[model samples]
Target: MERIEVIFKQIGTALRIIFLYKIVFLIACFSITTGWAKTITVCNTCDIASLKKAIAVAEAEDTIFIKKGTYKEFNIVVDKPLTIKGENFPVIDGEDQGEIIRITSDNVTIDGLFIINVGTSYTSDHAAIRVVKSEKFLIQNVVLEKLFFGIYLEKSNNGKVYHNKIIGDAQDEYNSGNGIQLWYCKNVIVGRNIVQKTRDGIYLEFSDNITIDNNISTENLRYGLHFMFSNDDVYTNNTFENNGAGVAVMFSKRIKMLNNTFHKNWGTAAFGLLLKEINDAEISGNTFEENTVGINIEGSNRITYHKNNFIRNGYAIKVLGACYTNVFEYNNFLYNSFDISYNSRINDNVFANNYWSSYTGYDLDRDGIGDIPYRPVKLFSYIVNRTPETIILMRSLFIDIIDFSEKVSPVFTPDNLVDERPKMKKIK
Candidate 1:
């Protein structure tokens, strides 16, 4: 019995030693991962003055804090998981040499830096900040100016670009680049960024599952928000104003655009929102005001436009054919020149429970809906679609007479295209 007790004591001692070794090993790993992380300061008087030198000497997960000064550097590459933060908005001037900062590492954060003067190269898309093939990255509170492409995310996923201001002096589309561009990226959130005067304010190609929210994109040389071949994207509470073309979504599916404002995007060829070959999208509670065309849809299907306000647009909704299974319900078309313009006489879409300012039907039953069906498309609109020069006589009495006569008997407009439940008052 004493020998057995001695043996059990020996076993317990061995287990205790193994557990102690494991605890020590875990401590060593914790030190390598987090406890040994240090901060490197960058300034003119500091030991590591240049950002490139600081990044080169930084260990993994170290922080590089840049002080307030102008550092003329370009082609700065971050190849490790590090935090590059600035105090009082340090300026990193690329001096028109090349790309400012390129992050090729995951779990990196770039915060509160002012980057400028990205080189203009037709061969390459030089960016103020570029995240390439990295995941779990964050770029916030960065100000970028004089850029070719501002904040370009290339094949990066699970990133957040927040509260950045990107402004460019792009004169021509061929020579300039987009302000914020996501190429082949997925699961990204671009929020609260103000981009202006660039080729396109924000552009996405082959990017999926992106959330673009509360961004103010205006005065771009091209579309304010343009995406193609992207799926499952959400754009909410964004303002697109005075762009060449406000927004364009093409060949995308399952997009949700809600509560956005498209205002003052005016040109002969410009539109507030252009949808081409889009499918299964939801557009709700948006306001399109004073645009040349409110929504220009072509080859789009299975879209739901609900509770939107189209105010004083040249053409509220212009369908250029091949649009089917789309529903426009509870919308307010207020004082648009032409409510709906269709090129084809065949109609497969439904327009129900909308309020039109030009609806002349009365409600004798005292309900909110009108008694008679409202014909939204006019013959003069069809004529203007064919002959653009005839828009000069839009307010003339001759045009009104022809429109009245066509309303009496449907000749050019689709005969079955009528709102059966037109609202007497504008939808709130």
Candidate 2:
């Protein structure tokens, strides 16, 4: 019985030793597979000559290097997790055929590529690079020109799009698309991009928790940055200039726009910033320069506008209707034709501690605050709202006399609309 027990113990020891060796072998194989991942090179003279062929044979988490040459490819779908890096800004011309690159998988990175000529289609929203339902993606250092839609993100999240240049030649709105558009996306960072001459430079629809900073969007056919139903988004240090309508924030809540520059957006319906149906937002430290209207507000409520500089605009702030509980303080309204134009006679908004360049009131006590209340709404502006043709008499002396009379007696404009504590000097 003792000899039988010894044989059984020897068999158990051998089985344990075999199991340990098998585990070590499996770990070693995994390490080799991870450390020696394949890199497919695509060029005119290479084993993998085309991007499509390289992607077809590439394993998961492989790297694909594209050489510096024009690859006329369209509808190139990236359905696997890979890294595509360009050697010297390789051109990916779509030949005006269709969509350029579509990414459907997660954990993808595309860098240093110049994509152009995305075909225009009324039925399909083609894009230079469309990231659809992907996560943990990075699309950076890319240049897109003559495209329909540049970097369109649809239902994608956790992505970064940085340092991309999108220059579109859009003549009209119907035939054009947006530069950087995010639809139903979240947790995305769009920074350091230059988008010009598109329908809308940066457009967000139903997107949340987005950060758009350090971007220059100018010369677009429509609004430079257009937000619709997007909430909890912050856009700071961006420049929107010379667009059809500068920046339109509509139907959005809890949005913060800080330290942005809106300049030189002039048209019949142009404005530096248009807020329609927006609520609970903050606009601070912004500059509105040389725009037709500094801000065109309509049906917005509970917004705070502070420390903004409105310079040389046609109307500094045009309050159309149904805007209430809006606070405007520490703002510099300089050289505006009309400081504030109110369409309604009832005023529930607050405007205080603002520096008006046209304020002629003298401070006897020299406390840097005007003792007399400054009425910003003018009767001539009210008449101009009714009859836009009367704007020709804006600089006439007769128009000034009527505006002065309306200030003394609150008949045509809102009586309660006054800046009681107006600043004597310009706001720094």
Candidate 3:
């Protein structure tokens, strides 16, 4: 039969090459869902003379509308999935030649821009807006000034940097700039921003599940919000003032500091919030005003300082030690010159039911909770904790008669670290 007619002509040429590969994969998915994303407008009477020549003749969901001019242009590369508008705020000048807008692509978009000269490298990290190795991106209402790094987010992931206004007149931390940086990024969503005099107004190093909400980081020269080794992050209602030590949560792990506002952050080693080696944190409803040191807990341990409010601080909490088992409940220790400063007295932490406006304990039968037991670890704070030069005679009178005889014989400060149940008021 002539070899059965050559095996039916090789099965009819394998069904005509599988029907022409399903008609070329359905016309490349119908040319990417029928449109390939259009809208490519640019003014001063033109179509594509600039804006990186309409992003090299746009494609991936195109849209590069630029109207108002001033484009001295630099290294702009929006690899695809585009949408780069600028109807009135277009001024992307990077004549300094470095990074003005270098997004590697993935659903990109940048609104009303104003990125300025950003090129002062010491090996390179230039940016006005650099979202390298991109993922879902969308940087809104941008206005990054004379920057060396602003709105930078390398190795990105689900991004959405909103309402950006990153100012950077950086002077120190090695030649400035960092108003919105997230390295090794993750689920990011830095919202409602307003960063000042840059140098970390919103920085996160090993970013993870980030969500810095309602931001208003002020006068920055260092840390208005500098997150290190980030982990499961979340800082709500933020307002870290006077920067230079306002908010530094280092070596993190499962943190969630809420309702933030740590004021002033004065010098000579300022701090209104600095908890190193933190772990399992949950500092709630925060507000540590007039800062000098209103929360500088080091070598942190199992943390949870709830319902916070510590005003007039020069020192409202400075606990350093091989800290263990932390938990200071229902806080509010107003009017501080020094409310608690421990170095160690061999004690575990648990300052309960707080509310100490200089507790002089006495609420007998008051039913509200203060049946005596307030001792917030003082005794000239254990002689400034073993002679920190005796803190300049902590207001003489022989250091208040040895802190009133260690508050009437309790010997060197940690008599079971009391605070038993002293909240007979103030929780508002």
Per-prediction TM-score to the true structure, in the order listed = 0.92, 0.92, 0.44
Q: Distance from true position, residue 217, model 1, in Å?
A: 0.2
- lDDT comparison, 2 vs 3, better candidate: 2
Ten-residue stretch with the least lDDT total in model 1: 29-38
Which lDDT tens digits does candidate 2 get at residues 252-345?
Answer: 9999999999999998889999999999999999999999999999999999999999999999999999999999999999999999998888
Q: Taking the tens digit of each residue's C-alpha lDDT, what string does model 1 give over 37-131? A: 88999997899999999999998899999999999999999999999999999999999998999999999999999999999998999999999
By summed lDDT, which 10 consecutive residues of candidate 3 come out lowest? Answer: 41-50
| RMSD per model, one decimal | 6.3, 7.0, 13.8
Q: Tens digits of per-residue lDDT for model 3 on 317-374? A: 8988877889998899988877888877777888899899887778879877888888
Task: TM-score winner between 2 and 3, please give it.
Answer: 2
After superposing candidate 1 on the true structure, give the runs of residues whose Cα lies further than 4 Å from its correct spot: 1-35
Best by lDDT: 1
lDDT accuracy of residue 214 in candidate 3: 87
Supply every candidate's count of residue pairs whose N, Cα or C atoms clash at under 3 angstroms. Answer: 0, 0, 0
The candidates, ranked best first by TM-score, are 1, 2, 3
